[model samples]
Target chain A: MERILRIFFNNGSFFTFVGLQLLCLYLIINYNSNQAAIAAETWSIRSGKFKSALTTVNGYLDLREQNEIHRREIARLRSLLPESGYNITTEIDSIQDDSLLQRFNFLTTRIVNRSPYNPNNTLVIDRGARFSVQPGQGVMNESGLIGIVDRTTDRHARVLSILHQSTRISAGLANRGYGTLRWNGLDPRRMTLIDLPDYVPVAEGDTVYTTGFSNIFPTGQVIGTVEKTERQPGAGSLNLTVLLSNDPLRATHGYVVQDLFKEELGSLNEN
Target chain B: MRGNDAISNALRFLLILFLQVFLFRQVSLGLGGKEYLFIYLVPVFTALLPLRTPRPLVVLFSFLLGISVDLFYETLGVHAAAATFVGYARQFALGLLEPRDGYKAKSSPEGKDLGNRWWMQYLLLMVGGYCVFFFSMEAFSPVYWRDIVVKSLFTIPVSWLFCIILVTFLRPRI
Candidate 1:
């Protein structure tokens, strides 16, 4: 080590000579225009090759996350298929037509928790008040209506599931008189249509839809297909246990529907 | 002792630099690329530094003088590099041409002390080498190899005579 140091430095004086010469040359290269351009061009070529090699390594490490984002994207795009074309109008920002003026503006979110078997099932959703998800706004998945927003925090909201004991939506046979849609405590897929007359001509496989009486859901939104009907013991009314299209346990993503004209309609109802 | 030597050396350096930049630098004559002569007189300063100076100090001082000339001429680093090489090589040249009696400690190389023939021989060897190195650097690149040689050949005689006059007149004494 000592011999090497002595030879390298010539006991330090040689070291000083070399160091000062290098510094002067470096200053000359930096201050002179031709030398600066040559240095810059050589530096860029070397650095670009180094960076691309690093990027190849980095790109492989990030592929798992990229795949997951792609999966979510596919799910969001599938919601746009022809069967659910009306659902595309949910974008409030893109509402350029008068037909969309009174429509609910929908913002999609995921269900984080659920009590599907409970007599009054409540759902937890990922969005909250900060996302403009207010109480009374309806929630739906690709298949059909899921619930209504009951309350919210900045990051999450609780939804009152349609299967809840107090849940009611104005629904009826297509082009028929309207009644209430509700669920019994027994089954998740079956919801009942209440207060249709016993002599009503509705049958199995008949489609029930929202009647527009409740400002919460738009008219013609599918509630269910009729599974069975039975006459009430004394009221001479027909009730149904229609199979709901959206099974709460199976559906993971849903949208909170904002009623743009809710305040105006509420004031008119109060008078 | 070091302080006195440094001050005297610094003064000589300034005088040589002024003469080179203001006097000999403007003496380029000839217009059509025939019989052209460009003299460089400042290198005599490097040749006549005190005989006892350390090799490294001589090289360093010569480089500084070269850089000072470069700043004025705007050639930049060409003269400085040439001077440094000459200064470093001077000890080898002296070893080759040393007298049979050897050199005195504090004496300068002069026509009177070293004999007029020895002085003239010293000037021809050192100043001739300086002109070749300087012009080669000025016309850098192997493509201009002939130009550098021609310029140096023409420049040396004129530059050498002028440098001899300057050396005899100054007679630099500590």
Candidate 2:
């Protein structure tokens, strides 16, 4: 027993090291869905509070620029709707008109942090679950489509920015009819719209917008312009380069497009 | 003397944690690759504590440092596991370096006491072990084998170099 104690004391560090390894292994193995849900809940509350405070602190610094943006947006919206005949009460009602309201209806949010460098670049917004923000909600700045909300806490949500390699948005050329916007993970300002047929007449600088095939983003929201087009032999598809309209680095604010029928659409699809 | 030592160690740990959380967390290296680096050498505080420091105290402090970092970084339990491993290995590191006469009284393993040559050796071994353990644990699967190895190899030298520079510059004379 004395000899055993001596040996144990002699190699105390090794024993502790082994013990920690086992503990880590236990944690990894036991990492469950329930635990993750609880963690998500906790993080939601904590991050929500933190984000709210941060926004409040930084509010003064951003007020002038944000005001200018709001003014421009108001002016743009006003030019489409006359002052006398347009009913302000129908702001929510107008969303039902898929054809008429395609150019308008945006939810404003502030970008707290963003990473364009990451392969899976993500953006954090000041709005979250408490503010009706949810996963799959589409986000856009004044210029164009920004991203889709991937995760949401109570007061903060993470956006899978369009710059991310994993992002694939349904897009259509203004002149042509079909394409899908995809990132090759090379440049934040550029993405590729692939699989368009060679017969499609895609001119340089032609506008591209969301197709609204998915319920996440509304139809006709501007994405970018066709920069370059290439027709590879025997491929049967035109590879088009697109320069994104929104400068993700400079975009401090955006709006989340919450589709009111999202839940209904999801339930219908599930059945 | 002991009280002063405790105060100095606490201050050091706090400083390192502050730098890691505020400044180093934002640094990224690779453009489109999986490589990333952060200033994790703050946990080296627990590792560099005097060899005669109580084992339980060292472990507890290391655990606290790790958990604190994890809370800020959104990576739960990972930093705790790595920091604890470092704390555990610290004694072995001291044992390997100490002469037959044992560690000098009131001497910490900073560059002043350990000297440049021994300090470099000690920092490299500890930092290298930490990088391997941290990257492997983070990857946690054979699929990311290449990623884990490359990331660990790339980050260890940079992290160790930063750690050594900081220790040499800020370490008080014995």
Candidate 3:
């Protein structure tokens, strides 16, 4: 018994090492989606608070540019709205009835923290669950679709940027018809639009927009412009290369579009 | 002896964590390749710590360093796994360099200490091991075989180059 005890103690370090490895392996294997969501939310909130405090010190420098951009956006939205006989109560009812349009309503926020360095890059926005921002909401800059909300906390949300490998948006050719917008993780400026029918008249410089198939994004939001197209022989689809509308590196502010019907849509699908 | 060493080691770990999370993370090699070179060097810092340490202590530090990096990199437990692997292999790396008994106190493992020729071998072994573990855990499936190969090949050398430079410049004073 004493000899056996000595042998066990001699190799005790190795056993401990193996035990730790097993623990880590378990962590890796049992890494739940819910845990990831929670972690993402916590990270977003913490980073957002830190970045917001940091950016506030520097925000004054960009005030002129930001004000001009805001004015231009308000003007654009005004132009889109019906000019005559529009009442506030009726508009509110209309917004409620059309969940997609309601879902398109945005909470403007500064990008407190951002990472363009990752294959599945995420951005932190200074707004969150308390502000009604939720996961799977669409995020966009003034130019176009930026990403989708992945997680949210009380004071911030993390957006899985379009630059991420996991980002897949239902997009279609403005000139042609339907396709899936996917990032190849090769070029930040360009993305690939696949599953496009070969017969679609895909011209160079043609615009691409969201199809609104998903509850996340509104229909007709611009995504990018087709830079090149190739018809693969025997394949029914065309390979299209698109230059993304927004330069991720330069974007500082964005809006998170809350998908009001997401719960309803989810429940309906389950039934 | 153990307690003082533990405190200093903890301090060093915190310093490296701050550097990775706040400063080096912002430095990205763009063009959609999706690579962060400077941040990968954080593990090498832990791996290059003095070899007189207990094996369990080394592994513990490696796990701590890796998990801290994972927190910032948003990669979950991948960096933790790779860093621990490198920590385990550090003894073998030293064996391939100088004789185990001939090692000096407070000297960092680097190209100079291990000699330049053997240093390349050491760096390749450690960095290659790190990259393989990192990319494999990240890819996590055989379906992304092409992507895994391409990403690993692109990132490994860049990470190794960063590790070499950092070790050379930050070699501990004898």
Candidate 4:
């Protein structure tokens, strides 16, 4: 022990030098932009690998609840079948509408990780780049919007939860003008809708839906219902409190929405 | 004499911090829309410490100075990483550049105590190394090797000139 102590003191500078360099490496990876990107990519892939085993265990624990959700979803999808609709114009020959184009495609995947408490929380889904899951695509379930895809690896993708502070969904009253929907980073069950004109009628229990202006989601998708409304004196707009329909913490499955015409629409905005 | 040396070193640290944060930081030299040069004088603080200063103290001081400048740069750890490397390597560099008669027992590495030629060579090695390491950390990958090389090449001579000017203006007596 004495000899070891002597050696340590003798080369203290060497040890400190190595130690400090390591600290600097850590800081560089965490804070610097280029290094941070590389670090984020590595961390997502590694964490996904480690979390998969735990996710398997959790999946078994939630099997019963998941089956119930699956049943509801199947029934809902079945209701959209043409056979379920009655043709009132049986006398006239049926003609398919050529003017309408299918623009949105949905890919289903399981949510493998949940982080609802963070100021900017994120979720990890089992689908990734190989599954055509790109960043900026929206993720939703039967309830409402879960989040937008933030980053992706080969087999998994990280989603920016609606509970995150940066989340701003373009939403509006089901019958009135639109506004921006935002999370206040304080409540998981509620969000704030701003920029809606005070002239527009807003009241408790009014449903809010995505305006489809951004092309990330289809028009008329349910976001939530207004729980509270406040208009400051002399303010031109009303601030609304919305109770979210989707609880991201309870979500196990999500459909990643890909807008087929997104690039075609986005290119015009760039010009 | 030792007390005076300590006070002067402290004052030098403050001066460099001021110049770095307020003055040099605002001056940007870019070419073709890419920022190719930055005036970095903070590394000189560690490079010119007294010849006999402990290596650990040198490394710690470099880390502090780099982090202080980083606060202004809003690039938290980039400068700190480069400065720490320079500080740790300073001893090896000094050993390489030692004169036939050797350094004075109680003198800082300044142009007056050391010959201008010797000081210039030392400044070139230290500041040049700083610029290369800094840009490398900023780029953070060999994929940006061209950018790193371009930035370091444009920045080295200018940074070296600033270090020389600083050493001359603040001629530490100790």
Report per-candidate DockQ: 0.06, 0.11, 0.12, 0.37
lDDT of 4 at A46: 89
- Please provide, for model 3 over B1-174, each residue's C-alpha lDDT reduced to its tens digit, 9 standing for 90 to 100: 221255555656776678767877787663566653333666665555666776666777787788778877776676787777777766666676665577767654544546767666677788887777776666565665776677667777877787677656545421
Candidate 4 positional error at A28, Å:
2.9
- The TM-score of chain B in candidate 4 is 0.93
**A76-132: candidate 2 lDDT, tens digit per residue:** 866866443455556766664444433434578999998747767889999999888
What TM-score goes with each of the models?
Answer: 0.43, 0.42, 0.43, 0.48
lDDT of 4 by residue, B1-174 (tens): 431267777877888999999999998889778898888998788876888888888888888888888888888888988888888888888998999999888777856657899888888889987888899888876788999998888889898999888887777442
| Superposed Cα RMSD, model 3 | 27.2
Residue-wise lDDT of candidate 4 within A1-271, one digit each (tens)? 9999998887766777778778888877867777899778878988998899889988898989978978988888768655675655554654644324468888999999977477899999999999888998999988899999999999999999888889888999877589999988888899999988989988799999999888878788999999999986687888999998888767889899999888999998995
Candidate 4 structure, TM-score to reference: 0.48
- For residues A55-160, write the lDDT of model 3, one tens digit per residue: 9978897889979979999888767654532446566656554332434467788899988486777899999999899888888877887889899999999988
Compose the digit string of candidate 1's lDDT tens values, residues A1-271. 9899768645343444454456545654555565466568768989999999999999998999968876887677667444556755556765555543445677889999887568899989999988888888888865688988898999899999998988998888875766788877778889999998777788799998887677787668887899998888999788888898778656788877788888888898895
Q: What is the lDDT of residue A142 in candidate 1?
A: 57
lDDT of 3 at A254: 85
lDDT of 2 at B82: 80
Backbone clash pairs for candidate 3 read none
Candidate of highest DockQ? 4
Measure candidate 2: CA RMSD.
24.6
Can you write out model 1's per-residue Cα lDDT over B56-76, one digit (the tens) per residue? 777788888878888998767
Q: Where does candidate 3 stray beyond 4 Å?
A: A1-65, A78-103, B1-174
